[model samples]
Target: MAATIEMPATRRPIVVAPMAGGPSTPDLVVAAGEAGALGMLAAGYKRPADLIAEIADVRERFTGPFGVNLFVPADASCAPERVDSDSAATGVADAEGRDRADRVAVEAFRDLLVQAAPDVHVPTPDWHDRDHYEDKLDIVEAARVAVVSFTFGCPQPHVVERLHEAGICVLVTVTTEEEAHTAVAAGADALVVQGYEAGGHRGTHRVTDAPNQLDHLALLPMMTDVGVPLIAAGGITTAGDTRRALGAGAVAVQAGTTFLLADEAGTTAATRMGLTDPRLGSCVTRAFSGRPARGLRNGFVDRFDALAPAVYPAVDQLTKPLRARAAQRGDIDGVSIWAGAGWRAAREAPAADIVDSLTP
Candidate 1:
């Protein structure tokens, strides 16, 4: 029988979820590590060189083991077909007199942006956005970080083998039991069982598939039979939630929303405002990133969720400028306030303090 994967020794069985965009920071990872929790650096939208630099920076601050999370590129079989250039430019309509969801949404949003903030310039969207998956993998192999996790999909077999050779533990985030099986088959050292309530992005292997609404606490039991270490993610707030996850056979609980307001996190002013604002509520919407992600519901999502296409990084790129402009203006309604259901419990304290409070 294959040996069971052993998680890193720590005072608490809590892991700080890697928050892409800006929340995951070196200080945040270092603080979590110092407090006896595993912390992850997000490499989703980073340049390979920049990712390496961030790794070096984290090592400088915290000597303990930490993790790096990467967004695996969409497999060719599942890559979204690019809409025709002519149709995209002309905003051609079908027999029903409705243009493609992606084109229409982009145009409408762009027009709104132009009217809302005429002086702000929006950048053109890149239809192909892989986030440099292969280059980032090479950096991880060279950095020799103790743990490397993949979201969006399981890494290819050879990539897993290479990381394993370098003494790096491979973790694959799976939103379903089927995805868990696939990751185990791909030789993943551990499984991050991300449930429907996970903030940011659902780690489902297929972007086209709608995420099944399963609580991570409930999903933990389903993945225990996978025979590997399971890290439960999503809506873990109080010590009670942690105990429940451990009771269900999860070796650790991963919490992102709980740490969104951590002092060390790079969460922006607008995002922090939205997170703490009592009026704000959370829901899953594909408007911002073109993938199902849980976040504080806002005007942007309300206006575009139904019209946004299932094309990721493309949709992510399409909305970048608008989000950037909104962020610059400190407009909470325009920025993507990615948060899980447990966001209300997030506290504005040191990452270590948050770790201590959650774990104990």
Candidate 2:
């Protein structure tokens, strides 16, 4: 028998989205939990030891309920290798040669990067980055967080069972109704219905699938039959947006961009500036990372979006050094300023205050 994991009682219908890569801090999660809402710790791009330390820190300061978010590893089997005598490295090959095309596209983009910014030396892409999927899961299971949420893809049944056995409720993020159904079938206790307006990466399961750009309200009606607690995410910055989601049948709302400017967030100066820049606009681009993510438009994206391939963490790894150099110099154009459509409405305040404002 699977041990029953009880859901945390959150008084507020608000959830702090796990803005991985820096914004998700222990203080931020603690503040949100203290404010009667559920906060999430992002385990993406984190070392297992570091994440365990953070779990310990958050547990010590805040006894209330919180969650941990993990990125499900991309299926490497999707890309089969074939010899391309003309290519510089082993390239992916499809029956129709689509994989070879992707490799060519990525190489072209790489050349563009070199020419665009000669001073910044980019690192060799790490093809093996699964974001430490299994190790992170082990840490989460051992820590026994109140909730364990997955993004990028749905977890296998055994993974869900293991988490359930450890007394943790599982939540899967979905961008389409099909994904919602898949999550429900996979035994997710809840669904994070992320719409196209969300900041950062679109949680579409397959890298090849173009994200459905539906709004939360529009997608809500499509997912009502999934029969699980629904958490609406994306473009939810103001109280009105929160009200709309709840009225549309969501049990809770998750907002990330609203908290980007929060005192507790580790938002970079470049990101902060881009978020507030009047001329900057948000758009979906795979320039920074191979996967499609929404961010404030800048020179780098303008130059590389067309050239970028559909590859994910590989492209992400390729751009790491360049982004880091840009960040060090406070150059907004070169780094990713991940923001949602409502970025202009973001305010600088405490995470608790943001939760309070969003709470009805």
Candidate 3:
């Protein structure tokens, strides 16, 4: 039997979105918690040992409730199969053939990266990399964090049962009504309905499927019948946005872009400048990570968005060094400046102040 664990109530109807790749730092998490919002640590790209250290760091500074977000591995079998002329003529392509084609596409993208950023050394894609999913799960369950949220894909029923057994609540990010139903059936304690305007990667369950363009307000009403607590995400940047989401049936709201400029966030200087720059506009592009994510449109995105393949971590790995180099040099055009539609409204402030301002 699955053990029951209730979602911890926060002083405000706000959750600090777990912005992976850098923004979600221990200080930011602690600050969000102190300000009466639930802060989640992004365990997406970190090693298990590093995740353990972070959990300890958060525990030491703040005894308040927090959560950890994980990226479930994308199923390779479900990857979109590209049918070439030969396969098209035959009208039949086996799994092995499709796998080969996918590899070829990824390789071609790598070559393009090499050309685009000649100074950066792009690594070959580790096709089987699972982002240490199993190891991270073991670490988080052992750590016994208050909430465990998942993105990319839903965890298996047994996995959810195990987390429940550890007395940990589980939240699953869903971008559509179907995903919301799937998460509920998988025994999620809550749902984070991420909308089209969200910054960072869209949490679509299937890698090949284009994320739905439904805004959170329109999407939230469709989820009220799912029988789980709903946390609306996506362009939620102010107290008014919070009220609208709650009015739409969300118990709380999750926001990341609004806090990109928060004093405690680990957002890079280049990204900080990009977010505040008046000339840049936000758009969903696959240029940086192969996955569709909303960010400030810049030269890199303008040049590579159309050429990138739909292979994550693979593309993400290829661009990591280039992004790092750009950040080190404080070049906003070269780094991925992820931000939501409400990014223009974001201002530099302490996370606690941001949380207060977001609360009605």
**Highest TM-score, which number?**
3
Question: TM-score of each candidate?
Answer: 0.88, 0.92, 0.94
Give each model's clash number.
0, 0, 0
User: Each model's C-alpha lDDT?
Assistant: 0.84, 0.86, 0.89
Better of 1 and 2 by TM-score: 2
As a TM-score, model 1 comes out at 0.88
lDDT of 2 at 54: 93
Which regions of candidate 3 fall more than 4 Å away from where they truly are?
Answer: 76-94
lDDT of 1: 0.84
Q: How many backbone overlaps does candidate 3 show?
A: 0
Cα lDDT of model 3 by residue, 113-215, tens digit: 8887787889988888999998998999999999999999888878899999998999999998888888888888999999999999999877667878889
Error of 1 at 111 (Å): 6.9
Worst 10 residues of 1 by lDDT: 76-85
Q: How well is each residue in 1-360 modelled by candidate 1, as lDDT tens digits?
A: 233345668788999999999999998999999999999999999888889889999999888999999998876222222344557544344312332565665666556546755776755666566788888888988988889999998877778888888878889999988889888888888999998878999997877689999998778888888878999899988888888888888889999999999999999999999997888898999888879999999988887778777767767876788899889889898999999988889988888888887784
RMSD (CA, angstroms), candidate 3? 3.3
Q: Candidate 1 at 25: error in angstroms?
A: 0.7
